[model samples]
Target chain A: MEITINQTPFKLPQGASIAEAIEIFGAEPPYAIALNLTFVHRQRYGETFLTQGDALEIVQPVAGG
Target chain B: MSLPENPDPLVLYGTSFPSRLLLGTAQYPSPEVLRQAVEVSGPSFLTVSLRRQAAGHNETGGQAFWDLLSTLKIPFLPNTAGCHTPEEVWTTAQMAREVFETPWIKLELIGDDYTLQPDTLEMVGVAERLLKDGFKVLPYCTEDLVLCRRLVDIGCEAIMPWAAPIGTGRGALNPYALRLLRERLTVPMLIDAGIGRPSHACEVMEWGFDGVLLNTAVAKAADPIRLAGAFKKAIEAGREAFLGGAMTQRETAAASTPILGTPFWHQNPS
Candidate 1:
């Protein structure tokens, strides 16, 4: 399955949960994940299944001063 | 009739400030602490910078600090701190406008790496562009009266002259130049950087500066929350002193004692 993250598309293995994809991509942890415009909490990543062409946005906190 | 103690609300760019102090949201041990410090500071306005964050890195449980600021409902001043060119500042200002939905931008264009001083030429160019585009520009530059005049001529809403280099905490290094700038510029002027202590902030306010914008002085303090409150009080005190008008120093000495002297202490007790 192919999913877009931060405007970039990436392919993932079959039957991959959001957690597995995150681990595979080595995405920075402790982030906010949104799949198809809906936020998925980190605790729920285990059950949240991914589908083809899913739009996922991972946002991190930046220093603001 | 009984009179209230403090009057004259600090006004900036048509906004009435209940507290003269402005705080920055950075360099705390944690965001929770930063939020608490901000509350303690009691600032009517806070400064935030725009930058790129790597994907999937969150220490505060996926909560962006700006989101927290939005929840707090305080007015945010978006700054273009790291921008070195006119294009970068303009683009950052546009993005800030789109994201924050506010037209106010803190224009900062750094010229040299050592001092981190603003490039006046680039700042003027960007200020003109932003003004034409209908954005309220708050330019942060050195204590150059001519540069401030140019900014005003180019239609900036306010001019922020640096007291010293950004984040050095050296305090006001050029009070004479800053005072000259204050004397010359008709628009609102804020002493923007190198304010290390509450007394330093107070000194600038007492010198008739309209306001002060600082970050490291509070953020890097041993106790940021306490320092924030101190800054708040100091700013208010300084403004009050300025309004009340201080006593002028005399060049010639005036004897505290009466000029008529005693009979030489009764002729030295002869």
Candidate 2:
């Protein structure tokens, strides 16, 4: 199945967990992810499952004013 | 003669800040420069944001930036930089709270791309949602009176109105409106963005604004560190001036010397 992470396409196994998607997406520690425009807590990453074309956003800290 | 330091500390969401200047962790040439600028400015609070991680790229400078921010020890404010809608802002704010573990958020809801102006209509709604979720919201808005009043009405304890558009560096675009806000709103008001120089920050402080937040002026300067120190001192000076009670301006000239101590060149000679 194909899932979109940060607008990038990635092929992952069906019923892939959010944690596994993070691993395949190369998101490092100290980052946050949103599945389908809603926040996914770190503790629930294991339970959150992703399907094809799921929009997952992995974001990190950056400069702001 | 220098006066005694002002004892008033800026209290936002129950936290007290000794320094009234808030630095932005953006536009610096490097992470080291941003760190040094924060060091000299002595700002108690700073602003940061969250960005989507680039594809197949983890070295997008997030870790190093976080590392530097950690060492600086300044409380970083997470903002919804490009979020156009309340839902976008809400989602981003939630993620930021988890990532930084801070309930404080600088909510930036842009309505127009050209001006990057904040969405006044939706600002209150966004703030209300965040406040309900126990997040301390400091909304970045224009120098509009009724909008600010509504934000206050919606239970925002602190509000940040732009001095000008973000990154314009024009400084205090509307003094009258800003003054009115300072007069009407009892809650903490921070002049954020469009500060071009130290004097700009000082002027806002002198006007009794609780604090000033800036990024481009200091970060884009030739000597960011020195400018940061200058801003720090200016804000302090302005705060002192406000506490000292500025004298009202006069239309006619007035003599500082008493007539009893007049010299030979006094009115008698004339």
Candidate 3:
């Protein structure tokens, strides 16, 4: 299956969970996930499944005024 | 001589802070400068934002930035900077809460791209939802009386209105409206943007505003550390002045010296 993380396309095995996608995308700590614009709690990362063409946003803290 | 430290602290959402200034973590020359500035300024809160993970640049400077923030130990007020609609604000705010581990969110719903003015019409609705979601929302809005009133009516404990457009440093473009908002709303009001100098922060603080949030002025200065200290003192002075109460304006001149005690009065023509 194919999914977009931070708008970058990635190929993962079918039935891949969000945790697997995080592993492939190389996410760092102090980050949060939103699956298709909905926040996904950290506890549910393993159970959440992604479909083809799903948009996943991995957002991290940055400097802002 | 400096006035005694204000015993009255700036309270927001039932939390009291010794300092009224809220500093931003962005645009400092370097992390070291940011650290020094934060230390010197001693702001009550530090504003931050969340951005999409930069693709391929995993070694990006985010780690160091986060590290610095963690070390500061100040409370974080994560903002929804670039969101245009309520949904975007919602998602961004949710992510911010999880990442920052704070319920405080600076709600910024931009209605225009050029001015970066918040969508006042949309802000009330967004704020209502965030408040219901258990987020302590600090909405960034324009200096409009009705808009501010609506926000307060909708359960916002504090409101952050721009002094001018973001990054403009123009400083309180509409003093009349801002003053009216201050007079009308009992909630804490903070001048969030368009503050260019320490005097700008002082002016708004003198208006009885609860606090000021600024970045570009200090961060872009030749010496961010010095400017940060300056802002800190200015805020304290202004708060003290406000608490001390100011004299009313007068058109006629009033002499400070005692008229009867003037030695040269006899020499003046009668």
Candidate 4:
């Protein structure tokens, strides 16, 4: 199956969790995940599944004004 | 009408802030420098951004920086920096709320690329929607009094008008317009961007603005830490001047010392 993560497509086995997608994407922790424009908490990441064409945003802290 | 007996806090969304200065975490030489700057300057609030967590390139200081901010224990106000659409602003605001655990958001919808001006037409809609969704929307908007008045009518208690475009450091480019805003707008106003010096911050604060927000001016300075201290002092001075009932300007020169008390006396029949 394929789901878009941060606008990038990735291949994974059936029923891939959001945590799996994060690991495969090679991103570290201390970031937040937004599934379909709604926030998915860090504790629930392992169980949060990504459907085909779903948009997931991995947001990290940055400097802003 | 009743008079305010004492100085009041910088109140927004029913919350009070101890300091009138707001700093940004961007463009610092290093996170450590930013930390020291925050410590020395002592702002009650600081602005932060959320970016796509990338691979091997924590361009905006990703996780480590987040941890550093946590240690600082200062409330970080998140911004929708690069979002062009209202939906983008909503998504970014939601993500920021979850990440920072705060409902406060600085809404930025870039309408133009060159001037970095905000989409004035869209700002009101975005602010209304965000407020409906239970987020404290502090919009970065222009000095257009009509548009700002509408925003205030839409239940927005606070609005930030740029002194100049973002990162330009030009200071208040249109003092007339901004001064007009100060005179008419009753809601709390924060001069959010284009402040290049401590004096700029002071001048705006002197105009009865509740606060001033800036980034590049301090972050890109030769001595960011010292510059931070300078801004802190200047903001205080400006706030005090405003509170003390600054004297009215005059077209003709007026002497402070009385003429009657002058030794070289006024009334003489020579």
Worst 10 residues of 1 chain B by lDDT: B53-62
Best by DockQ: 2
Against the native complex, each candidate's DockQ, computed on alpha carbons, is 0.14, 0.80, 0.75, 0.69
The value of fnat for model 2 is: 0.81
lDDT of 1 by residue, B112-141 (tens): 989999997778988998889888788888
Q: Candidate 1: which stretches are off by over 4 Å?
A: A1-63, B1-7, B60-62, B252-270
The 10 consecutive residues of candidate 2 chain B with the worst lDDT sum are: B53-62
Q: Per-residue lDDT of A1-65 in model 2, one digit per residue for the tens?
A: 99899888899999999999999887866899999999988999999999888999999988888
Report the candidate with higher TM-score, 1 versus 4: 4
- Can you write out model 4's per-residue Cα lDDT over B1-270, one digit (the tens) per residue? 985533568999888888888999989988889999999998878899888877775646687787789899999899999989888898888888888889899999999988989999998998999999899989999999998999999999999999998998889999999999999988999999999999999999999999999789999999999999999999999999999979999999998887776875755866
Runs off by more than 4 Å, candidate 3: B1-6, B55-61, B264-270
Q: Look at candidate 3 and give me any clashing residue pairs.
A: none
lDDT of 2: 0.89
**Per-residue lDDT of model 3, residues B51-126, tens digit only:** 9887454322367678878899999999999999999999999999999999999999999999999998899998
Instruction: Say what the interface RMSD of candidate 4 is.
Output: 1.6
Model 4 CA deviation exceeding 4 Å by range: A35-48, A51-54, B1-7, B57-59, B264-270
Q: On a 0 to 100 scale, what is the lDDT of residue A65 in model 3?
A: 80
Q: Give the C-alpha miss distance for residue B92 in model 2, angstroms.
A: 0.3
What ranking of all candidate models by lDDT puts the best one first? 3, 2, 4, 1
